[model samples]
Structures are given as structure tokens and as C-alpha cells.
Target: MPIHERSLIRPENLVTHENLVIDGVDVSGHWSTFITSRTVTDYNEAMEEEISALPGGEHINRCWQCGSCTNACTVNAINPEFNPRYWIYLIRLGMEEELLRDKEILWQCVSCNKCTYACPRDVVPEAVMKATAHWMELKGHTPKSPSTHFDESFTGSVIATGKIEEGQVMRSFFKKTGQPLNQPWLIALVRGLVLKFPITLLMRLGLSALIRPRTSGWGRTQAALNDYVSEVEARNSKALGLDGKGKH
Candidate 1:
């Protein structure tokens, strides 16, 4: 099959370098505002600072649409709609709305660093996926897929307990994602795997109670979440037409 007809934008049009469009919106008034709201960008600088800070950042500036990065990304290889190359292009160009809305396309990543491992210049598209997930979360947006919950629930349990209690985390995650505990067969399968390893079985049965993890202090985590809440509130206020988008 031919490639041109399948693409909405030709590969040639992509900017492999770090240039911005001067006409539509200046970086300050439009780009930085949208970027900062998502925590991926600071008011003074874009992801370029982080990208350039990477030892590979110098060549990242030279990525001239050869599709090397895109060809390297597993997400793009499987899903024709995904284009890591263009995503980086969007970040560089400061297409604010487009960048924010990009969050709607989620769970396309499997956290595989094959693209990063394969990059000749070390662009680290896997890091970009991580950045995108954090940015999306800041905007009060969530992925439709359960993969995220699969991680967050476990991690949240860890954050709360300093170690994961498999049984507790499973119940918590299932409740959050609206998934029920597995049927009897599934539970049996899991127990069978555990019981086969006596040491692991003893550990799972709470024989290691003396070494159980203690929780972290709540003061600092509360402060962090409070800051995030404030940022979301600020952005959502403007989103409700406070940014003069609704004055008419």
C-alpha cells in the first residue's frame, strides 16, 4: 500500500528542528499559558529545556522528520494514528490547545523504552509519554483505560504504606476502577501460584508482620496535593470562559 494517501499530513511538512510559528500566537500569551496549566511546561521555559538538557538534546534539535523516532516508537508502529515525531513537533511549536487536547488519546503507551533504546540521538520518547501522562493528570483528565489505574492504585498503596500489600491493593484498585474481585477460579489460580513458593506464600500470608512497612508522614504529601488542586482550580476557572473566551 502507498503511504501518502494514509497520512493526513505528509512526513515532509514536519519540523525536525526546534522552530516556532511566529504568526498565530506568541509563546507567552498562548503557548506558555496552556503549557504551564498542565505542569509539563513552566511559565518561563518549554520542554526544550528538558529535552536539550538530555545529552541527546543537541541532535534532538536536528530531528528533520526522517521518521526515525516515529519508526522507533512501538506506539506508532502498532497504531497508525500515533506519531511521536509530530507530538514533539507540536510541543516545540506551542500549539497550546492541540497539546492539551492530545491527552484524550491515552493508554497508547506500554512504557516500553524500545524507541529510546533504539534512538541514535537519544530522544527518549518513553520519557515524553511519561511527561504526557503527568501533564494530562494535572489537567484533571484521566485515561479511559484501566492500565493507568493498574499503576496508580499500586503506587498509591505504596505511597501510603511504603510497601504494597497485594490483597489490599487489589481490592482498592478494583474499587476505584469499578472492577470486581476476580471469580473463584481466578482467585484459586493466584493462590496456587503463591502456594507453590513456600517462602512467598508465607510472606503473603502475613508471616512477615514484623517487617511490614510503616506509613510516611502525611504533612508533605498533603502539601503537594494541595498545590496540584490549586493549579487545577486556576486553570478550570479560565476554562469556564473567564479567559475572555466567553465575554461575547
Candidate 2:
């Protein structure tokens, strides 16, 4: 559905005449306000296809503008400008410029999954938001978000060793995001783990943190995973026309 919400209109796009007369009647101020009309000369016809090519955006075409996703969105409830329905509409229509206008708020999605559950067509608006934010970063329209940094750190650990050490991932994430390791929550978590975790388990965790052990016979699997990840990255980069500028 076309967004006709007056609040969604940009203030600069709304023109108002302070003093105006039409047909022997006076219409001024808000009464004389009108939205500006402009032609979109640069529609990226491949925009939808590019976004769909990314993870979590595969079902973007299934969206029928039902508005259910927006209605159920947690962030939308707080910030109406964070409208998934509107962004999806713009993407489908290849309105790249219009979509970029809201690029900053795209990553604010909390991934509550309410929109996905409410979506009758399973559009998975939350995933679309993630994919869109990732698309922005890959295209260099925006910097990598803190969440993306965490994701990369976590994924890198797994791809390298095929083992997930919670503490290591946390430390890597904090380092990538320039956060201190002395976070209160992290300290509390460590304390709790030390207090309650089994003696053997705690020892293993500590040893692993120091040794950073790799899964046995993981070399072949690690190579395979690296190749798969490289393939996916290359494909996504080509789709977005990153021209070799895409971040891994």
C-alpha cells in the first residue's frame, strides 16, 4: 500500500504558502501546504534482485504490502520512521534513492521477529532489515555496525577452528568494537560461571581460552568452509557491484 501518512512526509518536501488566494478564497499556512512531486530518474532496476540475493532477503518478493509487519514491529512502535513496509516497497519499486534516505535507521531493527510472525506471507521483515543493513555496509554506504562486528568475530572463530569458545568470541567482539573487557555484565557472567560451572568444565574453558584448541582433523573442513564463504562473498559483491570493494 502507498504510504499516505502525513507525518511520513519530509518537512522540506512540504511546501506552504504564507499568503495565498485561489478562486477568490484565501488558503494559507498549513491549509495551503502541498507535497512536492518529483520524478525518479534513477531507479536501480536490480535493487530487489540484489537484496534478495543476500541472506534473509530471499522472500522479499513475497511481500504484498499488507502492513502487518509494520503493525507488529517493535521499533516501528517507537519510531514510525523505521517502517519496514515502506522500505520494502521502495526496494521492490527500485527506488534506491528513497530507500537510502532511511539507511541509518535500517539497522535499528531489534530482530524481535514480531513482524515475521505477523506477516501473512512470511516476508520475515526482521531478516530483510538485517540484510538491508548488511547491503548498505557492503556497498560502503554505511560503516559496519557493532552487531556486524560481533557477527564477524564470532563467525571468524568458527571458520578458523570449527570450535566456539564463548569467552574468546566475546573478547574478539569487544576488541573489534573497541569496547573494554571489564564490562560489568561480562565480569558478572564470568564470576557466575566460575562459581557454578563444573570444576572440569571451568578448567576446560580456561585451558581453551589459553590454548585456543582446534577441532581434530578440522583442516579439510576449515578449507571447505573458507572456500564456501569466499564464493558467497564474491557472488554478493558481484550482485551489489562492489567492484572488489566488498568487505569479507
Candidate 3:
């Protein structure tokens, strides 16, 4: 099919003549802007298969360009550049270079489930976004995004203790993201919580920092989960043509 979205075409691939005459008619500036035709020879034919191997990407091949995902996307409302439908089309076609154009904002998915609910084919576009972001990080196409860092921190805490303390998760996320924990909004939130529930707040903070709450007799369960996660990682890496060490 034709390019799914005009935004997907890079600016460099579009040519605009400052001055032009077409059949004695002036068609300069914006009127003269036209997409430059070029052959794509660097297709990563396995790109779609690799992404499909990741969690949430399994249903990517089911998408049928209904545009429901883009229409229902929360991020798309704020930034039209974040088009899930277009990205899915690119992935299905193995247009790796075109998909990389929006790599920086790919991880901004809010996971509101709007796209998932609206999808007619059970495409689960939300999961595809996560899988795409993970693929980018794994392939070294992009660094670990802040959202990825936050997810890893939260997941790590849960895997370690079979539970997560909100305070600890937040602290770990901020630290891993290299963000200051003393922001004004955070301070205000803490102040309000302390003012209303001083003892509760203190207990939570103390327990999270010092006591470290954990599930009782979780050793065996934790070990099992660790092994399962490691197995999944290895399988995903193999599917993506990566070495075991590159598993995320």
C-alpha cells in the first residue's frame, strides 16, 4: 500500500522547489513540494518476525489498518506524530528505517487501553508499542527510555519481594532515570500526605527504606519466576537474532 501517513515520509525524502513552472503555470514553494521517489533496498525482512517474538507483539500481524488504534490513542490526541496505526503498518512491511524516524517518542505510550478496546482485530496496539520500544532498546537502535527504566525498576522490586512499596519504586525509578527526587510537585504531594496522614506516611517510608516489606516464604516462588523470566529473555533474544548476553 501507499505510505500509511505523510508524516512517516522523512523530510529529506520530500523535494520542494523554490520556483517552478509546470505547463506555463507557477507551482512554487509549498505547491512544488513533492515526495521524492526512491527504491528501498535495505529492508530488514525479519524485522516484523523479530518484533512479533516479543511480548505484546504477537498480535501485530493481525492489524488490518483499521486506524482504530490511532483514533483511540491517547498520545495521538496530544501529538499526532505518535501514530500507532502507521507504525504497525511499517513494522508489518519491514520498513525498519521508516519506523526508526519516530523512535524517540515510541515509548511515550500511556497504556490507557483505549487502542486495545477499540481494535476490531484484537491487534492490541498498546502492547505493540511496548514491544517496539523494547525491540529498539534491544537492537541498540535507541537507548533505554525513561519509561523502560521505570518499568524495570518497578518489575525488579516486585520480582525481588513479591510486592512493591510505592515509595521505594518511585525512588528507584527517579534514581535510575537520573532525576531529582525533590521536585516541587513531589514535595507538595508529600506535604499533603504528611499533613493528612503523618503516621501512615512515616510508616510507609520507614518500612520501604529500612524494614523492606516482602512476602513470607517467597524464596521458592521468586526462584521459579526468575528462571521463567530468564527463559523468556533467552527465547526473545534468539528470535531477534541476538546473543544471549543481549537479552533485556
For TM-score, the strongest prediction is: 3
How many angstroms is residue 245 displaced in model 1 relative to the true structure, after the best TM-score fit?
18
Candidate 3 C-alpha lDDT tens digits along 1-248? 23456676777887778888899988787755778889998888999999999999999999999999999999999999999999999999989998998999999999999999999999899999999999999999999999998898988988899898887888889889899868899899888989999998887778769878899898998999999988888887888888746445
Q: List the candidate 2 regions with Cα displacement exceeding 4 Å.
A: 1-5, 19-31, 180-206, 243-248
Worst 10 residues of 2 by lDDT: 1-10
lDDT of each: 0.57, 0.87, 0.90
Task: Write down the TM-score of every candidate.
Answer: 0.51, 0.79, 0.86
Q: Candidate 2's residue-wise lDDT over 1-248, tens digit each? A: 23367776777887878888899888777756777897889999998998998989999999999999999989999998999999999999999899998877889998889999999998889999988999988877888888888889989999899888887997788788898868799899878877887797778877987898679889999999999998888888887887566364
Clashing pairs in 1: 16-63
Error of 3 at 89 (Å): 0.5
Worst 10 residues of 1 by lDDT: 29-38
- The TM-score obtained by model 3 is 0.86
Candidate 1 residues lying further than 4 Å off, grouped into runs, are 1-65, 96-102, 141-147, 182-248
